[model samples]
Target: MAYVLWEFTILGFDPTSFMFSGALIAFSWLLVNNRMMDTEALGRDQLFYATHDPVILMDAAGRFAGANLAARDLFGDEIPEHGGSLRQLNKIGPMLDCLAATGELNPAESISVGDRVYDPRALPIASPIQRRNNLLGWTVSLVDITERERSAEALREALSRAEAANRAKSEFLAVVSHELRTPMTSLKGSLDLMFNGVAGDVSDRMKELLGIARRNSVRLQKLIDDILDLQKLDLNTLNFELQDVEPTEFLREVMRDCEMHAAQAKVRLSVVSDDAEGRMHVDPYRLKQVVGNVLSNAVKFSPEGGNIECSLGATGDALRMSIRDSGPGIPENAEDKVFGRFNQVDSSSTRASGGSGLGMHIAKILIERMGGAISYQSRLGVGSVFHIDIPLAGGVPRQSSPPCDSVPGDGEGVPAFGEVRG
Candidate 1:
């Protein structure tokens, strides 16, 4: 006897009624043939046939036994006849062979049908009997991933374009900075000479105007230098002369250089080197520039009579340098913005302080390029502390030390330094 396994419900027949008749026919056939029925497998087959994603069932012989509505839609109305070899279907034969050999789907393999891309997966159906746990057939599911693949391709293209644009922008900035430097240097020198009475003695009013011009010209010159440095860094063209340097001597030099600025701000500068034996491998000039930038910022923000402390110590194959400033601390929300280019904690405050908002960003880039890391800790009412950690030369292990506090001279009293103003 022959029975219809599936009928189109669109053809004026209720799907529930057709399913009931099909089930009754299957049950009667099993009883008449004196064969045992697997109700669990039958229920699973019914559910599989109702799935929205295309599902195909193949018997142990690799012949198509059944397909779902989605599968019929995918393959067209003329699906493979019952017991027909699945190899006849396009791009499905190799996947079936892979599944038969490995008993699992190859996720990396995919099939393209028309404009859609599908990743095929296979699962073996085992016999229900405990003693005979053998493979009865296989269930293949095709998951369409065309949209996902397209989205990934689009993202890769966008990333490539963004990188190209960044390279172009960096190159443009480098060229523009070089062109502006020559004229700016000449203008600044002329202004400086006039202000200093080198060009000729002038009236008090004229001297005051020249002084303003000189100061602003100097500020502009500094901004141009910073832009050039940033561009060089971006292009990886900045040169470094790496050498072993003693931390104690290095800290002393940096502290000496910072004293002028600290004095100008009425902020005392002091250094404490607890572990002075460690040597750092870095470009002294570049490292000093990084340190100077941090010191300048500290001095700029620090209130009069407040102290700026520089400390150096060793911790596990790395040398740590921290700058502590008694200033209005960085706000919680503005902490992260400090390292971003042209970003300031408060634009109005930074403008009044005469900064281009690039000092901290440049310092961060310089430290990172020298194989060091820069970070800071701050509180709203207290003060701010910036730390730089650089690995020691020759990878020598550092001597164990107590955790460095965020505040320099936390327990130690601030030492006195004689007045040294710029």
Candidate 2:
């Protein structure tokens, strides 16, 4: 961030006054440099002076009234001590007129005199009356902004180059991932056929090796698919076919897809879904992708013979389906990091789960794009529950979104798994 972006202050000489360091100086914000001046009333209350910056005073007649020592040094002969008017100061005059005309001084319109540029800030000294508002000349402050503009321009250029590089990288990844998919699918199929004795009978040792190869090929294919999806998401090119879907029906269909994986992990699956018809606008494919990632994670982490429960209900106006897993729960502080790309709680090489850590990150983004959100709550010795919330079609958006991490056994908004809701 730029220094100007910070809410900063140049300490005023007098402790009683506030200086406008990071904002425009209106009538109430005129602070002087505390240096006494012979400019009479114009410099009496320290209103026409600056310690380092140039501050100028012009009479209501548009003639230069007075300038402080700094302003004198900066403008030199252009200070117009010979009663020259505001219209004679070359660029500064027109800039002031343009600013007053538009009621805005664009940063790009700063006065560039020789090698230095300055942002001209002006405020009309005035007094209100019954008939007509009175104008008491003007106070114009010239703030040197050469370095600030240069730094901003450089930062903008750097950002442009970085974005171009990132886009190219995403394009390359998408192409390579697509190309690798066909060969990976063939490799996995061939391994399966060979293990099944398609090329004559295979020994037990040969079968074991083929199993390892096949499993790895499957893993590799998943990585490729995830990378491609991630690229599409980053490029904002992924299309979703959104349609109204009934809540319970959607969960049942997704359950079937996760059934085989859950069974292989020696885990039981159950649903406590609302049988009543309800509508949720969502992209079926994207929603499935989200549920699949969460379900797969649950399966990988569940203890053998453990149970994973899926529930569908209305969490406010939105439909929420929470998937609870009977695994060692995540730490309470791990909420934010859980959805961060390429991040993992157990990052050690000996960690049990194997993944590129892009699943939850991509899932979070996809769910959000569908006017929904994903959240979780966990207890160390108990388990973790992932709450996937999506707004019902044509329904009001959720307001005053409460905290997502509900305390289990605390009798809160939603109860923990194994605890029935009334």
- lDDT of candidate 1 over 353-418, digit per residue (tens): 877878888888888888887777766556777777776787654555512355533454332211
lDDT of 1 at 329: 75
Question: How well is each residue in 200-305 modelled by candidate 2, as lDDT tens digits?
Answer: 9999999999989987898898899999999999999999899988777788899899898889889998885454335889998999999889888888888999
Give the range where candidate 1 is weakest over 10 consecutive residues by summed lDDT: 413-422
Candidate 2 clash total? 0
Alpha-carbon RMSD of each model: 11.3, 15.4
**What's the TM-score of every candidate structure?**
0.77, 0.76
Give the Å error, residue 187, model 2: 1.5
User: How many clashes show up per model?
Assistant: 1, 0
Q: Report model 2's TM-score to 2 decimal places.
A: 0.76
Q: Candidate 1: lDDT of 120?
A: 85
Off by over 4 Å in 1: 1-52, 76-79, 235-239, 272-275, 332-334, 349-351, 377-382, 395-422
Task: Name the Cα RMSD for model 2.
Answer: 15.4
